[model samples]
Target: MDEAARRRWHQQHSGSWLQLVATLRNEGWEAQVTCEAAPVQVEGTLPSGERFYFRARHSDVSLGIGGDDPADIAEWEASESHQEASYLPAAVGEAMIRRLARRYLEER
Candidate 1:
Protein backbone atom coordinates (compact mmCIF):
# COMPACT_ATOMS: atom_id res chain seq x y z
CA MET A 1 0.00 0.00 0.00
CA ASP A 2 1.25 3.45 -0.82
CA GLU A 3 1.35 6.11 1.86
CA ALA A 4 -2.14 7.28 1.05
CA ALA A 5 -3.49 3.78 0.84
CA ARG A 6 -1.75 2.78 4.02
CA ARG A 7 -3.28 5.66 5.86
CA ARG A 8 -6.68 4.72 4.52
CA TRP A 9 -6.26 1.10 5.51
CA HIS A 10 -5.05 2.02 8.92
CA GLN A 11 -8.09 4.18 9.45
CA GLN A 12 -10.50 1.61 8.09
CA HIS A 13 -9.00 -1.26 10.02
CA SER A 14 -8.86 0.80 13.16
CA GLY A 15 -12.54 1.62 12.79
CA SER A 16 -13.41 -2.01 12.29
CA TRP A 17 -11.49 -2.95 15.39
CA LEU A 18 -13.36 -0.32 17.33
CA GLN A 19 -16.69 -1.76 16.20
CA LEU A 20 -15.63 -5.24 17.27
CA VAL A 21 -15.06 -4.27 20.88
CA ALA A 22 -18.77 -4.01 21.52
CA THR A 23 -19.64 -7.32 19.92
CA LEU A 24 -16.83 -9.07 21.70
CA ARG A 25 -17.95 -7.69 25.02
CA ASN A 26 -21.42 -9.03 24.37
CA GLU A 27 -19.84 -12.42 23.83
CA GLY A 28 -18.82 -12.49 27.49
CA TRP A 29 -15.32 -11.21 26.93
CA GLU A 30 -14.16 -7.88 28.24
CA ALA A 31 -12.85 -6.78 24.87
CA GLN A 32 -11.36 -3.34 25.07
CA VAL A 33 -9.82 -1.82 22.00
CA THR A 34 -7.62 1.19 21.54
CA CYS A 35 -7.36 2.18 17.92
CA GLU A 36 -6.83 5.90 18.11
CA ALA A 37 -3.20 5.41 17.26
CA ALA A 38 -1.20 3.34 14.89
CA PRO A 39 -0.64 -0.28 15.88
CA VAL A 40 -4.07 -0.59 17.41
CA GLN A 41 -4.21 -2.89 20.39
CA VAL A 42 -6.93 -4.96 22.02
CA GLU A 43 -6.93 -7.03 25.18
CA GLY A 44 -9.68 -9.08 26.66
CA THR A 45 -10.41 -11.65 29.30
CA LEU A 46 -12.89 -14.33 28.49
CA PRO A 47 -15.55 -15.34 30.94
CA SER A 48 -13.75 -18.63 31.40
CA GLY A 49 -10.74 -16.63 32.61
CA GLU A 50 -8.79 -17.18 29.41
CA ARG A 51 -6.90 -14.16 28.26
CA PHE A 52 -6.90 -12.80 24.73
CA TYR A 53 -4.72 -10.15 23.24
CA PHE A 54 -4.44 -8.66 19.77
CA ARG A 55 -2.31 -6.03 18.15
CA ALA A 56 -2.53 -4.86 14.59
CA ARG A 57 -0.69 -2.19 12.69
CA HIS A 58 -1.41 -1.87 9.02
CA SER A 59 -1.35 -5.36 7.52
CA ASP A 60 0.79 -6.90 10.23
CA VAL A 61 -0.84 -8.48 13.23
CA SER A 62 0.25 -10.38 16.32
CA LEU A 63 -2.04 -12.38 18.55
CA GLY A 64 -1.63 -14.01 21.93
CA ILE A 65 -3.80 -16.80 23.16
CA GLY A 66 -3.71 -19.45 25.86
CA GLY A 67 -1.76 -17.00 28.00
CA ASP A 68 2.00 -16.81 28.27
CA ASP A 69 2.52 -19.83 26.05
CA PRO A 70 5.07 -18.97 23.44
CA ALA A 71 3.59 -21.60 21.17
CA ASP A 72 0.22 -19.92 21.42
CA ILE A 73 1.42 -16.63 20.10
CA ALA A 74 1.62 -15.90 16.40
CA GLU A 75 2.24 -13.02 14.04
CA TRP A 76 1.18 -12.76 10.43
CA GLU A 77 2.22 -9.89 8.26
CA ALA A 78 2.81 -10.33 4.58
CA SER A 79 5.04 -7.30 4.64
CA GLU A 80 6.69 -8.05 8.04
CA SER A 81 6.34 -4.58 9.61
CA HIS A 82 4.80 -1.23 8.75
CA GLN A 83 7.60 -0.22 6.41
CA GLU A 84 7.87 -3.54 4.60
CA ALA A 85 4.25 -4.60 4.91
CA SER A 86 2.93 -1.52 3.19
CA TYR A 87 2.88 -3.48 -0.03
CA LEU A 88 -0.30 -5.25 1.01
CA PRO A 89 -3.35 -3.73 -0.60
CA ALA A 90 -5.84 -2.24 1.81
CA ALA A 91 -8.65 -4.60 0.83
CA VAL A 92 -6.53 -7.70 1.18
CA GLY A 93 -5.15 -6.71 4.52
CA GLU A 94 -8.53 -5.74 5.83
CA ALA A 95 -10.00 -9.07 4.79
CA MET A 96 -7.17 -10.93 6.44
CA ILE A 97 -7.66 -9.12 9.74
CA ARG A 98 -11.40 -9.65 9.69
CA ARG A 99 -11.01 -13.35 9.09
CA LEU A 100 -8.38 -13.71 11.73
CA ALA A 101 -10.42 -11.79 14.29
CA ARG A 102 -13.50 -13.84 13.56
CA ARG A 103 -11.60 -17.07 14.01
CA TYR A 104 -10.05 -15.91 17.23
CA LEU A 105 -13.37 -14.90 18.70
CA GLU A 106 -15.08 -18.06 17.51
CA GLU A 107 -12.43 -20.28 19.03
CA ARG A 108 -12.61 -18.43 22.29
Candidate 2:
Protein backbone atom coordinates (compact mmCIF):
# COMPACT_ATOMS: atom_id res chain seq x y z
CA MET A 1 0.00 0.00 0.00
CA ASP A 2 1.04 3.57 -0.56
CA GLU A 3 1.87 5.86 2.36
CA ALA A 4 -1.54 7.52 2.12
CA ALA A 5 -3.36 4.20 2.18
CA ARG A 6 -1.27 3.04 5.13
CA ARG A 7 -2.10 6.19 7.09
CA ARG A 8 -5.78 5.80 6.30
CA TRP A 9 -5.68 2.23 7.53
CA HIS A 10 -3.96 3.31 10.73
CA GLN A 11 -6.52 6.00 11.29
CA GLN A 12 -9.33 3.54 10.81
CA HIS A 13 -7.83 1.14 13.33
CA SER A 14 -7.18 3.95 15.76
CA GLY A 15 -10.80 5.01 15.46
CA SER A 16 -11.90 1.55 16.46
CA TRP A 17 -9.63 1.63 19.52
CA LEU A 18 -10.92 5.07 20.42
CA GLN A 19 -14.47 3.80 20.18
CA LEU A 20 -13.67 1.01 22.58
CA VAL A 21 -12.06 3.44 25.01
CA ALA A 22 -15.06 5.72 24.90
CA THR A 23 -17.45 2.86 25.45
CA LEU A 24 -15.49 1.59 28.41
CA ARG A 25 -15.38 5.04 29.97
CA ASN A 26 -19.12 5.50 29.45
CA GLU A 27 -19.68 2.20 31.22
CA GLY A 28 -17.67 3.38 34.27
CA TRP A 29 -14.26 2.00 33.47
CA GLU A 30 -11.21 4.23 33.29
CA ALA A 31 -9.82 3.55 29.84
CA GLN A 32 -7.06 4.82 27.58
CA VAL A 33 -5.81 3.95 24.11
CA THR A 34 -2.63 4.10 22.02
CA CYS A 35 -2.53 3.56 18.27
CA GLU A 36 0.89 4.00 16.71
CA ALA A 37 0.33 1.30 14.10
CA ALA A 38 -1.52 -1.91 13.16
CA PRO A 39 -2.09 -3.17 16.70
CA VAL A 40 -4.03 -0.56 18.54
CA GLN A 41 -3.94 -1.04 22.29
CA VAL A 42 -6.39 -0.20 25.04
CA GLU A 43 -5.88 -0.41 28.76
CA GLY A 44 -8.67 -0.02 31.27
CA THR A 45 -9.10 -0.14 34.97
CA LEU A 46 -12.37 -1.29 36.43
CA PRO A 47 -13.96 0.24 39.51
CA SER A 48 -13.20 -2.96 41.32
CA GLY A 49 -9.44 -2.46 40.87
CA GLU A 50 -8.98 -4.82 37.97
CA ARG A 51 -6.70 -4.09 35.03
CA PHE A 52 -8.06 -4.94 31.62
CA TYR A 53 -6.40 -4.79 28.22
CA PHE A 54 -7.43 -5.06 24.59
CA ARG A 55 -5.36 -5.29 21.43
CA ALA A 56 -6.38 -5.60 17.82
CA ARG A 57 -4.73 -5.77 14.42
CA HIS A 58 -6.82 -6.33 11.33
CA SER A 59 -9.21 -9.19 12.18
CA ASP A 60 -7.30 -10.39 15.23
CA VAL A 61 -8.38 -9.17 18.63
CA SER A 62 -7.15 -10.17 22.07
CA LEU A 63 -8.63 -9.28 25.44
CA GLY A 64 -7.41 -10.11 28.89
CA ILE A 65 -6.91 -8.93 32.44
CA GLY A 66 -3.63 -8.54 34.39
CA GLY A 67 -0.24 -9.98 33.43
CA ASP A 68 1.56 -6.80 32.53
CA ASP A 69 4.76 -8.70 31.90
CA PRO A 70 4.24 -9.38 28.24
CA ALA A 71 6.55 -7.60 25.82
CA ASP A 72 3.71 -7.07 23.39
CA ILE A 73 0.07 -7.84 22.64
CA ALA A 74 0.84 -11.12 20.95
CA GLU A 75 2.84 -12.27 23.95
CA TRP A 76 0.03 -11.27 26.24
CA GLU A 77 -2.43 -13.36 24.26
CA ALA A 78 -0.13 -16.36 24.15
CA SER A 79 0.73 -16.27 27.83
CA GLU A 80 -0.79 -18.97 29.98
CA SER A 81 -1.89 -16.33 32.45
CA HIS A 82 -4.45 -15.29 29.91
CA GLN A 83 -5.52 -18.72 28.78
CA GLU A 84 -8.91 -17.44 27.78
CA ALA A 85 -7.44 -14.88 25.38
CA SER A 86 -7.74 -15.88 21.76
CA TYR A 87 -8.34 -14.40 18.32
CA LEU A 88 -11.61 -14.71 16.44
CA PRO A 89 -12.47 -13.77 12.85
CA ALA A 90 -15.65 -12.17 14.16
CA ALA A 91 -13.46 -9.62 15.93
CA VAL A 92 -13.35 -7.37 12.89
CA GLY A 93 -15.41 -4.17 12.24
CA GLU A 94 -17.57 -1.87 14.38
CA ALA A 95 -20.04 -4.57 15.35
CA MET A 96 -17.26 -6.68 16.78
CA ILE A 97 -16.14 -3.82 18.99
CA ARG A 98 -19.66 -3.47 20.36
CA ARG A 99 -19.93 -7.18 20.92
CA LEU A 100 -16.57 -7.33 22.62
CA ALA A 101 -17.42 -4.33 24.78
CA ARG A 102 -20.67 -5.96 25.80
CA ARG A 103 -18.87 -9.18 26.57
CA TYR A 104 -16.29 -7.29 28.61
CA LEU A 105 -18.95 -5.54 30.64
CA GLU A 106 -20.87 -8.75 31.13
CA GLU A 107 -17.98 -11.11 31.76
CA ARG A 108 -15.41 -9.02 33.56
Candidate 3:
Protein backbone atom coordinates (compact mmCIF):
# COMPACT_ATOMS: atom_id res chain seq x y z
CA MET A 1 0.00 0.00 0.00
CA ASP A 2 1.09 3.52 -0.70
CA GLU A 3 1.09 6.44 1.73
CA ALA A 4 -2.42 7.54 0.74
CA ALA A 5 -3.88 4.08 1.17
CA ARG A 6 -2.28 3.68 4.59
CA ARG A 7 -3.67 7.02 5.76
CA ARG A 8 -7.16 6.17 4.51
CA TRP A 9 -7.12 2.79 6.18
CA HIS A 10 -6.07 4.25 9.53
CA GLN A 11 -8.71 6.98 9.31
CA GLN A 12 -11.39 4.38 8.66
CA HIS A 13 -10.57 2.64 11.94
CA SER A 14 -10.29 5.77 14.09
CA GLY A 15 -13.95 6.09 15.06
CA SER A 16 -14.32 2.57 16.42
CA TRP A 17 -11.08 2.96 18.33
CA LEU A 18 -12.21 6.20 19.91
CA GLN A 19 -15.53 4.63 20.91
CA LEU A 20 -13.68 1.82 22.62
CA VAL A 21 -11.55 4.26 24.58
CA ALA A 22 -14.62 6.19 25.66
CA THR A 23 -16.39 3.06 26.83
CA LEU A 24 -13.37 1.92 28.82
CA ARG A 25 -13.06 5.27 30.53
CA ASN A 26 -16.77 5.28 31.36
CA GLU A 27 -16.37 1.92 33.06
CA GLY A 28 -14.04 3.49 35.65
CA TRP A 29 -10.78 2.50 34.08
CA GLU A 30 -8.06 5.11 34.50
CA ALA A 31 -6.68 5.20 31.04
CA GLN A 32 -3.48 6.71 29.68
CA VAL A 33 -3.58 7.04 25.95
CA THR A 34 -0.43 7.20 23.87
CA CYS A 35 -2.09 9.00 21.00
CA GLU A 36 -5.46 9.76 19.43
CA ALA A 37 -4.27 9.26 15.90
CA ALA A 38 -3.86 6.11 13.89
CA PRO A 39 -2.70 3.07 15.88
CA VAL A 40 -4.30 4.19 19.11
CA GLN A 41 -2.72 2.74 22.24
CA VAL A 42 -4.13 2.81 25.76
CA GLU A 43 -2.92 1.51 29.09
CA GLY A 44 -5.51 1.35 31.84
CA THR A 45 -5.59 0.41 35.49
CA LEU A 46 -8.69 -0.34 37.52
CA PRO A 47 -9.26 0.45 41.17
CA SER A 48 -8.63 -3.18 42.06
CA GLY A 49 -5.16 -2.92 40.51
CA GLU A 50 -5.86 -4.94 37.40
CA ARG A 51 -4.00 -3.51 34.44
CA PHE A 52 -5.15 -3.57 30.85
CA TYR A 53 -3.40 -2.73 27.62
CA PHE A 54 -5.22 -2.10 24.38
CA ARG A 55 -3.87 -1.35 20.94
CA ALA A 56 -5.82 -0.69 17.79
CA ARG A 57 -4.41 -0.44 14.29
CA HIS A 58 -5.92 -0.54 10.88
CA SER A 59 -4.68 -4.10 10.40
CA ASP A 60 -5.46 -5.57 13.83
CA VAL A 61 -6.31 -4.89 17.46
CA SER A 62 -5.30 -6.62 20.69
CA LEU A 63 -6.25 -6.55 24.37
CA GLY A 64 -4.27 -8.02 27.23
CA ILE A 65 -4.19 -8.02 31.02
CA GLY A 66 -1.09 -7.65 33.15
CA GLY A 67 -0.22 -9.28 36.49
CA ASP A 68 3.35 -9.59 37.58
CA ASP A 69 3.19 -10.64 41.22
CA PRO A 70 3.61 -14.34 41.79
CA ALA A 71 0.69 -14.55 44.22
CA ASP A 72 -1.55 -12.59 41.94
CA ILE A 73 -0.61 -14.75 38.99
CA ALA A 74 -1.35 -17.87 40.96
CA GLU A 75 -4.71 -16.56 42.11
CA TRP A 76 -5.64 -15.49 38.63
CA GLU A 77 -4.64 -18.88 37.26
CA ALA A 78 -7.07 -20.52 39.68
CA SER A 79 -9.84 -18.00 39.10
CA GLU A 80 -12.74 -18.39 36.70
CA SER A 81 -12.03 -15.39 34.51
CA HIS A 82 -11.64 -17.09 31.20
CA GLN A 83 -13.81 -15.99 28.33
CA GLU A 84 -14.48 -17.40 24.89
CA ALA A 85 -15.92 -15.54 21.96
CA SER A 86 -18.88 -17.39 20.50
CA TYR A 87 -18.78 -15.30 17.37
CA LEU A 88 -16.63 -12.54 16.02
CA PRO A 89 -18.02 -10.67 13.08
CA ALA A 90 -15.77 -9.19 10.44
CA ALA A 91 -16.41 -7.52 7.12
CA VAL A 92 -13.46 -7.10 4.80
CA GLY A 93 -13.26 -6.27 1.15
CA GLU A 94 -10.49 -7.67 -1.04
CA ALA A 95 -8.64 -4.37 -0.96
CA MET A 96 -8.73 -4.22 2.79
CA ILE A 97 -7.49 -7.76 3.05
CA ARG A 98 -4.62 -6.98 0.76
CA ARG A 99 -3.77 -3.92 2.73
CA LEU A 100 -3.87 -5.85 6.01
CA ALA A 101 -1.59 -8.51 4.62
CA ARG A 102 0.86 -5.98 3.39
CA ARG A 103 0.90 -4.18 6.73
CA TYR A 104 1.39 -7.43 8.62
CA LEU A 105 4.33 -8.40 6.51
CA GLU A 106 5.87 -4.97 6.75
CA GLU A 107 5.61 -4.95 10.53
CA ARG A 108 7.16 -8.39 10.83
Candidate 4:
Protein backbone atom coordinates (compact mmCIF):
# COMPACT_ATOMS: atom_id res chain seq x y z
CA MET A 1 0.00 0.00 0.00
CA ASP A 2 1.02 3.62 -0.53
CA GLU A 3 2.16 5.60 2.49
CA ALA A 4 -1.22 7.26 2.95
CA ALA A 5 -3.14 4.07 2.43
CA ARG A 6 -0.76 2.20 4.69
CA ARG A 7 -1.26 4.76 7.38
CA ARG A 8 -5.01 4.45 7.02
CA TRP A 9 -4.82 0.68 7.19
CA HIS A 10 -2.58 0.80 10.22
CA GLN A 11 -4.95 3.14 12.00
CA GLN A 12 -7.97 1.07 11.12
CA HIS A 13 -6.28 -2.17 12.10
CA SER A 14 -5.06 -0.70 15.35
CA GLY A 15 -8.48 0.60 16.20
CA SER A 16 -10.06 -2.70 15.35
CA TRP A 17 -7.59 -4.41 17.66
CA LEU A 18 -8.44 -2.08 20.53
CA GLN A 19 -12.18 -2.49 20.04
CA LEU A 20 -11.75 -6.24 20.06
CA VAL A 21 -9.95 -6.11 23.39
CA ALA A 22 -12.67 -3.94 24.89
CA THR A 23 -15.39 -6.25 23.69
CA LEU A 24 -13.59 -9.28 25.03
CA ARG A 25 -12.91 -7.63 28.37
CA ASN A 26 -16.56 -6.63 28.70
CA GLU A 27 -17.48 -10.26 28.14
CA GLY A 28 -15.36 -11.28 31.15
CA TRP A 29 -12.33 -12.47 29.22
CA GLU A 30 -8.83 -11.41 30.30
CA ALA A 31 -7.13 -9.43 27.56
CA GLN A 32 -3.64 -8.01 27.22
CA VAL A 33 -1.90 -5.69 24.74
CA THR A 34 1.38 -6.40 23.03
CA CYS A 35 3.60 -4.80 20.37
CA GLU A 36 5.52 -7.71 18.95
CA ALA A 37 5.53 -9.14 15.43
CA ALA A 38 4.19 -12.65 14.92
CA PRO A 39 3.22 -14.95 12.12
CA VAL A 40 -0.50 -14.51 11.67
CA GLN A 41 -2.65 -16.85 9.71
CA VAL A 42 -6.34 -16.46 9.07
CA GLU A 43 -8.56 -19.12 7.60
CA GLY A 44 -12.19 -19.46 6.67
CA THR A 45 -14.06 -22.71 6.61
CA LEU A 46 -17.08 -23.07 4.37
CA PRO A 47 -20.15 -25.15 5.02
CA SER A 48 -18.89 -27.64 2.48
CA GLY A 49 -15.74 -28.18 4.62
CA GLU A 50 -13.59 -26.19 2.27
CA ARG A 51 -10.85 -24.27 4.06
CA PHE A 52 -8.78 -21.27 3.08
CA TYR A 53 -5.63 -20.11 4.81
CA PHE A 54 -3.73 -16.87 4.53
CA ARG A 55 -0.31 -16.32 6.04
CA ALA A 56 1.00 -12.92 7.03
CA ARG A 57 3.04 -10.87 9.45
CA HIS A 58 0.96 -9.14 12.13
CA SER A 59 1.74 -7.03 15.14
CA ASP A 60 1.25 -8.46 18.60
CA VAL A 61 -1.02 -5.56 19.51
CA SER A 62 -3.32 -6.48 16.66
CA LEU A 63 -3.53 -10.12 17.67
CA GLY A 64 -4.89 -9.63 21.17
CA ILE A 65 -8.46 -9.16 20.03
CA GLY A 66 -9.85 -12.68 20.35
CA GLY A 67 -8.95 -16.31 20.87
CA ASP A 68 -9.78 -18.95 23.47
CA ASP A 69 -6.22 -20.18 23.85
CA PRO A 70 -3.84 -18.19 26.00
CA ALA A 71 -0.70 -19.73 24.48
CA ASP A 72 -1.65 -18.55 21.05
CA ILE A 73 -2.40 -15.11 22.40
CA ALA A 74 0.93 -14.90 24.18
CA GLU A 75 2.78 -15.99 21.10
CA TRP A 76 1.21 -13.11 19.23
CA GLU A 77 1.88 -10.70 22.07
CA ALA A 78 5.54 -11.65 22.27
CA SER A 79 6.04 -10.51 18.71
CA GLU A 80 4.69 -6.98 19.23
CA SER A 81 7.75 -5.14 20.54
CA HIS A 82 9.66 -5.51 17.30
CA GLN A 83 7.20 -3.62 15.12
CA GLU A 84 8.04 -0.23 13.63
CA ALA A 85 6.68 2.87 15.35
CA SER A 86 3.32 4.27 14.29
CA TYR A 87 2.72 7.98 13.59
CA LEU A 88 -0.92 8.25 12.58
CA PRO A 89 -3.35 10.80 14.02
CA ALA A 90 -5.52 9.85 16.96
CA ALA A 91 -8.69 10.90 15.15
CA VAL A 92 -7.83 8.68 12.22
CA GLY A 93 -7.26 5.83 14.60
CA GLU A 94 -10.61 6.40 16.28
CA ALA A 95 -12.45 6.58 12.99
CA MET A 96 -10.80 3.39 11.82
CA ILE A 97 -11.79 1.66 15.01
CA ARG A 98 -15.42 2.72 14.70
CA ARG A 99 -15.63 1.45 11.15
CA LEU A 100 -14.05 -1.85 12.14
CA ALA A 101 -16.35 -2.20 15.11
CA ARG A 102 -19.36 -1.79 12.86
CA ARG A 103 -18.04 -4.36 10.44
CA TYR A 104 -17.18 -6.84 13.21
CA LEU A 105 -20.57 -6.49 14.88
CA GLU A 106 -22.34 -6.90 11.57
CA GLU A 107 -20.42 -10.10 10.94
CA ARG A 108 -21.63 -11.61 14.18
- In angstroms, the error of model 2 at 89 is 10
Per-residue alpha-carbon lDDT of candidate 1 for residues 1-108, written as tens digits (9 for 90 to 100): 699997987777666666666766776777676443455566766556656565556656655655463124533212224442333333443455456556666764
lDDT of 3 by residue, 1-108 (tens): 999997876675555545555665676666665554444455666434656554445545444445663222311211111122111111222133224333433443
Q: By TM-score, rank the candidates, best first.
A: 2, 1, 3, 4
Please give the range of 10 consecutive residues that has the lowest summed lDDT in model 3.
79-88
> Ten consecutive residues with minimal summed lDDT in candidate 1?
75-84
lDDT of each: 0.55, 0.52, 0.44, 0.37
Candidate 3 global TM-score: 0.39
TM-score of each: 0.47, 0.51, 0.39, 0.36
Ranking 2 against 4 by lDDT, winner: 2
Highest-TM-score candidate: 2
Q: Of the candidates numbered 1 and 4, which has the greater lDDT value?
A: 1
Task: Mark the regions of model 2 whose C-alpha exceeds 4 Å error after superposition.
Answer: 35-38, 56-62, 66-108
Best by lDDT: 1
Task: Give lDDT tens digits, candidate 4, residues 1-108.
Answer: 799997887777666656654664565444433431144333322122222222224222222223444234421222222242243233433344334334434544
Residue 57 lDDT in candidate 1: 62
RMSD of 4: 12.2
